[model samples]
Target chain A: MNFPSKLIEDAVNEISRLPGIGKKTALRLALHLLKQKESVSESLSQAILKMRTEVKYCAVCHNISDAEICGICASNKRDRSIICVVEEIPDVLAIENTAQYNGLYHVLGGVISPMHGVGPDELKIASLMKRIEEADAGVKEVILALPATMEGDTTSFYVTRLLSARGVKVSTIARGIPIGGELEYTDEVTLGRSILTRVNYSAE
Target chain B: MNFPSKLIEDAVNEISRLPGIGKKTALRLALHLLKQKESVSESLSQAILKMRTEVKYCAVCHNISDAEICGICASNKRDRSIICVVEEIPDVLAIENTAQYNGLYHVLGGVISPMHGVGPDELKIASLMKRIEEADAGVKEVILALPATMEGDTTSFYVTRLLSARGVKVSTIARGIPIGGELEYTDEVTLGRSILTRVNYSAE
Candidate 1:
């Protein structure tokens, strides 16, 4: 599609490079930006540039941060004896949003997907092992909170095998029907897994 | 949702401010940007900023342009006798894409909508009249190609009334069922209009 201005064409092209955004949507977004206050565009541009160039990953957990170590790793309130491993930064955010986990996080950056050319060496597996095996780290438990996919399971199994050799305790989050999920609509594998891992009922 | 870092949160907030984008989508975009090369974010940010700050409106037609006069208006090949009036800049691009019209265009910027606090004065209506009334301009015919909405109709009627007083020929694009549209699924209003405006079929 032709744009009335070169600047608009350039903007639309760059915007459409992003995932899920097409040329039409990019054009619409560019037009909307044109109609808004200059400060709006200024802030948006500045924020994106600053985030891309300056954002740091925590030295210990590999989570996004502004300093050497992330807030979760730095906070004394968090359980340093436990580290929940995940695939990406968004996973850390999702688990944090639940407010149910008080342990630290170790972002693997990505799972071991041979199809995608991502191997164990491409992730933070070595850094994770280093943190857990530290003589003074006192890491008692390592939780695998990854995706419910073949790649996630493969990564988990690999990590579990390595951790078990080092005499470190490893656990996984339960896979079952989600909270408020109807049993009728639940997949058979998940339903069967839920039944196999059933816990004693407690009214209190 | 909570962000791992202030920078990520700021970037997400700015991105979410765009139309049709929510916090979750914004987060996804921010994360995607983080994973991409720094050059990608730099180009996206720079393009948006440049487009917003530097884009110009044509002096005569009011379409988005890089110079005071748009390329269409500056060109000698385009017919100056007729003008196709549209509601916004994108409409000009849409018509240009069709390659059916070779005449110049007058972008109204928007239609009259009292509910949105947009009056005739808010658009380029006055500039359009100025261009048409110019003695040496030699503009003879004006085509109303606004939207099919009430505000579009109101603007069209108002422009036609004004142009008629000056003895200028005014016409409107036909409204009917679209090309390749199935008759069975056509809406009642459009099907009725298509039948009413049916023209004699010409083999030549």
Candidate 2:
């Protein structure tokens, strides 16, 4: 589309570079910004630039943080013995929102995907092994909370194999029909897994 | 959702304020930006801020431009005797893309919408009238090329009533079934309009 101004064209081009945003949507967003107060645009630009320039990653867990070590890893309240392994910072946030897990996290940054040229060495897997080997840390069990995709499975398998030799218990999150899912609508693979992994019910 | 860092939280909050973007989508976009090169984020921020600060509007038609007079309004190739009135700058681009209409434009900025607290005074209606009255411009006709919505119709009606007293020819774009639209699937109002406004077939 022909833009009346080079500035608008530049803004639209930059905005359309974002994932899921097309040229039309970018134009709409640029016009909306034009109609809004100057402070709105200023704040948005400042926030984005500041976040990009000053963002930090936790040295221990590899999760995004403002300090050397993340809050979860540094906190005494969280259980250091059980570490939940995740693919990214957002996964850590998703698990934290449940408020069910009190253990620290080990963010692998991403799962093993050969298609994307991401290998085991590219992730934080080596650091995870080092953390587990530290006898003073007292890490006993590692929960594989990564996605259920093939890449996730490959990463989990590789991590578990390495941990088995080090005498650390490695477990994966249960895969089955969701809590509120209907059995008839559940896929065959998940339904079959749910039955095979069934456990005895107890009132206690 | 809980973010690991204050910077990420602030960026997410600001980004989510944009139209059609929710908290979850904003989080995803923010994380995507974090993973990209720093120059990408810097350029996006710089473009948006610069556009907002330095963007200019055309002096004659109020369309967005980099200079006082827009290219369309200042061009000698465009028809000066005919003006197509539109709701916004996008409409101008849409018509221009067709490569059919060569007339100049008068951008109303927006339609008359009392629901949104926008009225005739808020738009560029008065300036349009002044342009029509200017003897040197030689404007002989005005086309109402607004949307088919109620607000668009209301604004067109108001403008037509004001222009009728000045003895200038007034016309509106035809409302009918769109090209490639099926007769069975077309809406009743549009189909009826199409039939009512049908022209005599002449083998040219």
Docking class of 1: high
Q: Give the alpha carbon lDDT tens digit for every residue of B36-74 in model 2.
A: 999999999999999999998999988898889998988
Give per-residue lDDT, candidate 2, residue A177.
90
Q: Which pairs of residues collide in candidate 2?
A: none
Query: Compared with the true structure, what per-residue lDDT tens digits does model 2 show for residues A1-204?
Result: 888889999999999999999999999999999999989999999999999999899999988888888788889998889999999888999999999999999999899999999999999999999988884777889999989899999999999999998889999998999989999999998999899998778943
Task: Give the lowest summed-lDDT range of ten residues in model 2 chain B.
Answer: B195-204
Give the per-residue lDDT of model 1 (tens digit) for B1-204: 888899999999999999999999999999899999999999999999999999998999999999999999989999999999999888999999998999999999999999999998999989999998883768889999999999999999999999999898999999987889899999999899889888878953
- Candidate number with greatest TM-score: 2
DockQ of each: 0.90, 0.90
lDDT at position B10, candidate 2: 99
Best by lDDT: 1
True-vs-predicted CA distance for residue A95, candidate 2, Å: 0.4
